[model samples]
Target: MLNKTRGRPRGNPDTKARIAEAARELFLERGYKGTTVRAVAAEAGVDSALISYHFGSKQRLFGQSLNLLCVESTALDQALQGDQAGLADRLLTSVTSLWDATAPTENRMALQDDDTMRAFRDYLESELLVRVAEFLGGPDATERATAAVGVIGGLIFTRSLNPIRSIAALPSAEVRRIFGPALRAALHARARQH
Candidate 1:
């Protein structure tokens, strides 16, 4: 004879998402070095084993957490697929348009602080710049991609932070006209071979 024990369900359907969300918040607060799986599990209100079970390891968890901020933009993907010429403009335009459309959600109050924003920026570099490097696919692709991403990040930060009224208030077209050349230079700049 076996006794059947009935109680609340032992598992949560949303645990994976909850863990990812907790990991993101912790990464933003503590950064990659400071965050731990145990801490993330505590934050997520689950056992540490669940973090290991779901994410496998801290590095994987960090990667997954960074992915949370990524909103797929077909336009951006298309922009990256064409000729290298005008890529900067296309990339910038696609990014700006997407940002404009999703500004409310992307610029949520929780990400308003400097530390959180810095963390977010670092995550963006890891996620977006790495892909940009892979897309360029050449000897100096990584170097060029870093510079290009830096240009894009600077433009975004300035525009969103509204530090300079002229740059911030300029229409998107005007922005594309002015900053496009700089991004192009970054994307195509050559590194001297050692």
Candidate 2:
């Protein structure tokens, strides 16, 4: 027999979906620091262990919940072979779109939606980052990617702190007007250093 769940009932696919969705919503609303397993289970209407069972742990669950659609360039796995200009365009579009799509609509758990946020330093050292860095080029890719992802993810995550919903809204030209030069500079610097 399945383990008698402790906090809430056992979950099926529907229930699992609810839990994951709830976890994402609440984590975004509360930030990783503020959210807890109990709270996630409550929001999901499933036992807390079900969350553990489905996701292994809070961090893993959080990562899984954040598996947003990836742009092809960023998905390269290892190599900056993609068109640099195209990669820049896709990166901005995907990030901004994901940020916009983070709205806590359907389930609307007592949590604001956010595109995603890793635990900063911890996530930076994570396997996910490792793979993403490899996609940028490899271990050496860190310097190139770090600045770009940091600024982009920071913008998306920090917007959550604002009371205003549309604060993140910006035209592509404007975004390019700002980060484009800096990112270009960063890539060049990395190329020189490497």
Q: Candidates' lDDT values, in order?
A: 0.71, 0.54
* TM-score, candidate number 2: 0.48
Leading candidate by lDDT = 1
Question: Lowest summed lDDT over 10 consecutive residues: which window, candidate 2?
Answer: 104-113
User: What is the Cα-based lDDT of residue 83 in candidate 1?
Assistant: 85
Best model per TM-score: 1
What would the per-residue lDDT of candidate 2 be over residues 1-194, giving only the tens digit for each residue? 66565644534548777887887787667655667889999887777877877776666666556443221223232233465545555555555554455552311222233335333334434433454466667445777677666665455444433423544456545655666666655543455542
TM-score of each: 0.64, 0.48
Off by over 4 Å in 2: 1-13, 18-81, 104-121, 124-128, 162-169, 191-194
- Model 1: runs farther than 4 Å from truth? 1-20, 29-76, 103-111
- lDDT by residue for model 1 over 1-194, one digit each (tens)? 53222222255688878989999889888875677888998898877877777777665677466552223435546678888887888897876675566553344443556766766576557656877888888899998999998887777666654336777677778888889888999998878767
